[model samples]
Target: MNKKFYFKSYKTKVTINGETITVSRKGFFNLVLLRLRTQVINLNNIQNVKLKEATNFKRGYLKFVVTKGLKHRNVTVIFNVFENEIAVEMKNYIQTINNK
Candidate 1:
């Protein structure tokens, strides 16, 4: 995996696809503490969640931010696929610590 982006702490929670992905001081810190490194490629502008080469997990992790029947910021939870599920392979590219 390649390092490409960084996440900043938000004061409030953001909703994505009906699911409230919290980014609070406590919860968000935990996700970062795990040191997950993966780029969140926002494909909302394309108006489609399915990509041309989405099924190809062997290449890399791919997530689509769906916002069809929602009312907040769209998001996609992506992770490296292994065997038959999304694999949590991060830490190599990103470092987690106190956001201060």
Candidate 2:
């Protein structure tokens, strides 16, 4: 059995759910404003992972491609984290998921 882990920011989180990574937005009001977007991608579905460092007042993004031929990406975006520990944890978690 594995534990569910959350790499969280002010507005969003990338959570580990068994063999899948669930990207979701926090706060109910924001959901109403942003139109409620959530994405779940299996570790096996992932082909690549990229992290872009965030600047002041900007959120960093953790992007992974599930399908090679997809038109757009649906990834996890977190605020107040550029080169942070949570990012490192998420990256390590991805590697673990890949190894399994």
Candidate 3:
């Protein structure tokens, strides 16, 4: 099954399937200025995952530490209070995959 979550405030979307996780940014500004292209990460390539719970004053973020070369690059998706649960779920799902 394919599960998708969208965070409107951050203009980011995360899609989880059995084998891969896909992340894409929405809006023209994010596409052009940020140069944030869609990232398709395989389950095997994820080194670690982190989820920061959202507070009233600050937005939380789900970060994926992807294995690239000698250094790791973080792919983060920001989420507000309303999206906290979904972000946690995504983190849990990735952890489960890594354990297997």
Candidate 1 on 1-100: residue-level lDDT in tens? 2222212222222222222222222245445764433323222332333222224444333233445455433333332223112112222111121111
TM-score result, candidate 2: 0.68
Ranking by lDDT: 3, 2, 1
Most accurate candidate by TM-score: 3
- Flag the better candidate by TM-score, 2 or 3: 3
Give the clash count for model 2: 0
lDDT of 2 by residue, 1-100 (tens): 3444454444665667667777767687458876665778777777888877677867676678776456545565554554566776777778777887
* Order of candidate numbers by TM-score, starting with the best: 3, 2, 1
- Candidate 2 positional error at 60, Å: 1.5
Off by over 4 Å in 3: none
List clash counts for every candidate, in order: 1, 0, 0
For 22-76, candidate 3 gives per-residue lDDT tens digits of 9999888677887886989887778889889998999999888888678778888
Query: Which 10-residue span in candidate 1 carries the lowest summed lDDT?
Result: 91-100
RMSD of each: 14.7, 3.2, 1.8
Between candidates 1 and 3, the one scoring higher on lDDT is: 3
